[model samples]
Target: MAKVAVLGAGSWGTALSIVLADNQHEVRLWTHRTEQAKKINQTRRNDQYLDAVIPEAITAYSDLKQAIAGVTAVVFVVPTKAIREVARQVDPLISPETTIIHASKGIEPVTLKRVSQMIGEELTAFKEEEIVVLSGPSHAEEVALRQPTTVTVSSVDPDRARLTQDLFINESFRVYTSPDVLGIELGGALKNIIALGAGISDGLGYGDNAKAALMTRGLAEIARLGTSLGANPLSFLGLPGVGDLIVTCTSVHSRNWRAGNLLGKGNKLEDVLEQMGMVVEGVRTVKAAYQFAKEQQVEMPITEGIYQVLFEGKQPKDVVGQLMSRNKRQEMDDLAQLLMERYSQ
Candidate 1:
């Protein structure tokens, strides 16, 4: 088994450390807080993020240098907002040969860069080909419970992508390799916006019909934007795209959905975020996505609605009414046109 360093000790990071340990890999889980790392090392239980008993092979580290010492691979599961800061620190410590894997899902709000792009900008020690992205529908909570979970690893380097697949695959955890890194990143990041919409629909007393419409249409918009940016449109139809969309929009463990639910229940945005106590990526992604969609000339009504509700103080009911009252077009015709346009290129 190889030694792996997982940066970030949040729920997702903690859960991923558990998976690495289960696979017999020595894992150094890093958190900035010395007390938390010491506590995790002593207790073997990260009660704040997960209740699962951590395996003995997994140790927590407060020092970044110590955590990354001589590791074969480094998995970054930090929030999108923190990706740059973490990558800067890791840049000097990371070996050029070390495979950098990021599981965080979100676009940088100000720059509109994907997680991989941000890491690429900061981690000059690593080549772009050395970066891999692990993304799909697998929630941290269920994965920690040893539930059956599957994800896709994508990279410009096919060999490295396959290596990432091998690193994470096990009996309960299935991994696939893909060359469409942009699609994987876009799908994983954009789906959180739809998940928030789904939660908002639920919180507003809307039925499944509302959520289903929101999810599917929201997906169409995301695909449109992703394709415009040179991502494989078909990639979105697979794990990172449709699969992640389903899980995030429907799953109870989605923090983005929970945040939206609180917003729909008339809580202030600040209050919703404060109550979540987790990085609701959708909140930040919506801002960047909204700006990007406009720049790309892609029509994303669902994203716009969520953006307005969160940032413009538009009520949930008002947005829903506006969405329903919009001029109509054939759904299949639009989808077919998009597919044709993408495939023709």
Candidate 2:
């Protein structure tokens, strides 16, 4: 057991805190909101975000310094938009040897950088071996209740990846390690876009065939962009990519999917966001993905369609029709061509 600091009191943060405490590790959770910290400390519960279960061994702190002090590792579970801010606040307090793991999944909209890169930019004092990313199909709601889950922790250093794997792996929550940090992080971030597309399909009352098609094609777009950015293409077929997509796109727990569902049902994006009350990552990700696709010259029809619906007032039904009416192509055409090019290299 190790002393761990969870720098965020959101649903995912609380869920991860529960896991740490359940595994008999001492966990100090940090939040900017004093009232929220007080509530968690006094009642051992996080009602607004994760109301199902709370671990007694976990404590909440409003002071970032106190939360980060003397911890063996820091696990970041904050919103992607706030990661840099939080990193700035926590850097001075982090020990040089402390292992860092981030569970948040989303790219920085303005920077178009993954959370790990943002963390690196903020914490210039830490070496690359000290950072890792933990992501996969696990959702905070399900994990907080101790339901079975699995996730991946990827870092450039294989030893560091294994250490991360050991930290979170349990009978109920499994962990896998990978050295493909860029690929894993990129896959995790981009899958949310596809989940949004999946939600749109659901909202349109489209059948499983439609949803499956969105998921499959959406992955191709994700892989294409990631590979263009120097990420390993094979990582797309692994847990952080396809496995996470299956859960996010198909599961009701995904906020991105839910947001898309509302859009498909004729609700405006603004209205859906207002109703969610929490961060809907896919909305933020759409603009970043759009910019990334254009910059990388990647073809992402599903993402493009969703972007139009959200920003250009395109009808979701019309977008669906446009997709179905596109030029016919072979099933393995893209994959085979991509592999052939790789072999030529």
Candidate 3:
């Protein structure tokens, strides 16, 4: 069996470590906190992050070198912001042959780089094809409970993605592969922004109709921006796209959606983030997407509206009005607009 290192011990990280352990692989699950690692090793209970018991095959470590040594693969589940630092620390510990997989979903606000890109930049020894992105609608809580879940892996090298597929796929966790790395990353990262919007809509007491419209149109904006960046528009239609959007927007497990729900209920951005006690990626994602939209001249009214609420201190109610008051567009099906001839390239 292949040995793997899973960085970060948060909900997502712990869940993925469980997947690896269940697959019977020797998993080195690393956390930055020494006390947490000791607790995990002693009790097999990552109580703060995952409610499920970590399998015996998985070992927790606070040392980066000990966790990565001789591992054939490394799974990065850290927050987007910590990706660079962790990757840099792991770079000297693992060989160039160690395949890198990242499930951290978000774009860097400064460089607007996807998590894989950040890893690639920091782990200068690993080539672009070595990086694989795993994303879909699966929630950490569900996955930890061994609930049936599906996710997709993407890379520049289809073979590499397929290899990752074999490592994680099991009866409870199904894995798929896609060639559209750009689209996969875009869909995964941006859906959190839409989910935040969905939460805001729910927070405002806008019934299903309002949320329906928001989700539908929010998808349009995602496809629009994704296609402009040269990602296959069809990727937005797959697991990484609409599948992810639906789960994150609708599920209570989604931190982004929950954060938006708090914002919708009149909490300030700082207050919402502080109260959640976990990283709300969509808050940062919206800002990056908004900046990218402006730079690319793409129309992302929903993202723009959310950005205003989160950063500009605009009221959620007022942003809703602004979104509704925007100029008209053709009522054509979003499918037509998203998959138009121009995006075929």
- Could you tally the backbone clashes for each prediction? 0, 0, 0
For model 3, residues 141-195, the per-residue Cα lDDT tens digits are 9999999999999999787899899999999999999988889999999999999
Question: Which pairs of residues collide in model 2?
Answer: none
Model 1 error, position 40 (Å): 0.5
On TM-score, who's better, 1 or 2? 1
Alpha-carbon lDDT, every model: 0.91, 0.87, 0.90
Worst 10 residues of 2 by lDDT: 331-340
List all candidate RMSDs to the true structure.
Answer: 1.1, 1.5, 1.3
Better of 2 and 3 by TM-score: 3
Ranking by TM-score: 1, 3, 2
How well does each candidate superpose onto the true structure, as a TM-score?
0.98, 0.96, 0.97
Ordered from best to worst lDDT, the candidate numbers read 1, 3, 2
Show the lowest summed lDDT stretch of 10 residues, model 3.
331-340
Global local distance difference test of model 1? 0.91
